[model samples]
Target: MKRISSFAFIFVTIVPFVGCHTSSQNVLEKKVEVKLEAKNNSNASGLVKISEYANGEIQITGTITGLSANSLHGFHFHENGDCSDNEALKAGGHFNPDKSHTHGKSIASTEYSKQHAGDLGNILSDENGEAKIDIIIKVPSLTLNDENKYSLLNRSLVVHQDKDDEKSAPAGNAGKRILCGVIKS
Candidate 1:
């Protein structure tokens, strides 16, 4: 009986490791580069990398150069990927996950519903107009394919002059739409 119990324990532990290795090997990994451009020669560029995990874990990194230091900027994914001359028009709208109204509020707001799908958080730059952002986001409703259902592909990243006020009107008075980019796969 003792021998049988020990064998069972070993098998249970070892089996999981084998299963994990096999599962890890089967997962499809993808990388994408996003080029950010300043609307009025703001001189800002950055790269965004996204990795898909099985448990809704998305790793994002945004490294920007040529920005104002010690300033708070609103960073988010816009509805459209268009980067036309008009940065405001190119960015489309904020990224609201709950289909809420347009508002530049905190990410923890309960009111101001019906928001856009790309309303992320803020981006803080360093003294030399550089900001490196690394975060893990949860996208429960996102897939790896491009079907226009809250898809990140062909989406634009917009940087605002001021912080988003989650409950305000017409972009929460987030100031000018300075930087824009199109997320590509």
Candidate 2:
């Protein structure tokens, strides 16, 4: 009877742990893909691809054909992910985890806290008027999956014309919002 009681207690305790581990796995495993289209009255359309892995790093790539070869552009993640009509508004304000007003990552004051969550560096075009970019960023919403956690599902992506001031207000005078898209799983 003593041996049987010990076994029962061990099994009960182990079973709950196993269940909890599996459940946590399911919650943490998620793959998100985001596609972007840049369009406006002044320029041609552009394409961008963003992949969110389970490890919390985001990979972003973009290409713009027929644009100025030697021009610089701005990229960032907005607050919302709604890609419906007027994607600009859906993107919300810049991702301000620390509530700072810096624009691009390069110009940020604290390297980590100066720039907003959406503040990516400039996307430069080559002589062929094509811009290709690859970047890795650590985002809270893209990394966390707990129901009580905040996600970037409702956030939007924006491409700007000029370089981000990294200390400017609104949009760093980055011209206009050329392209916009929402992130999703």
Candidate 3:
């Protein structure tokens, strides 16, 4: 009888705690942290955190270092996650799941159809060669759900040598990829 009462008390104490903890954790179901790898001798490295909210808003925040001081670098999402190639060619082109083949304005653009779904615009580095990223993408199509065609997971984030011109045909004339990081949940 004592053992049964002890088991019941323990179960009662832990069950509610676990339930409450899981319920609060469900707020951000899709959150991933990616570690960047340097390419093309750019010597850049960073940690990026991507969080998907319940309302379809994606928040990306991180800090990249070893970039050109006080300069702008083009940052975009690539279709492929492979970064084996030194030039980052293995990552493929920008993620344009929306069929917006044309490279239009980047994150600043309000029209989703005008730009590639992965077009994140330029990230400026400070004097210390560190670029802090804090951007919220309000696009519904770019999600973390594995079933979605436009899911960002398993994709690659590429940092370019130059700033995105925002009007170039193929990839905004961003030059060669200098850093790459695969996004995962």
Which predicted model would earn the best lDDT? 3
Which tens-of-lDDT digit does each residue in 30-148 have in candidate 1?
A: 55767777776577777767666666555668688877887778877777778877655756777654564466544323322445546566778889988897866555555445546
Count of backbone clashes, every candidate in sequence: 18, 8, 0
Cα RMSD for predicted model 2 = 9.0
Cα miss at 54, model 3 (Å)?
A: 0.4
Q: Which ranking of candidates, highest lDDT first?
A: 3, 1, 2
lDDT of 2 at 50: 61
Better of 1 and 3 by lDDT: 3
For 116-165, candidate 2 gives per-residue lDDT tens digits of 66677677878886788777666545443442224556567777767776
lDDT of each residue in 24-106, candidate 3, tens digit only:
65356588998889999888899999999887788889999999899999899999988888999989989888674578777
* TM-score per model over all chains: 0.73, 0.66, 0.82
The per-residue C-alpha lDDT of model 3 at residue 92 equals 93
Question: Of the pair 2 and 3, which is ahead by lDDT?
Answer: 3
Q: Evaluate model 3: give its TM-score.
A: 0.82
C-alpha lDDT (0 to 100) for residue 36 of candidate 2? 65
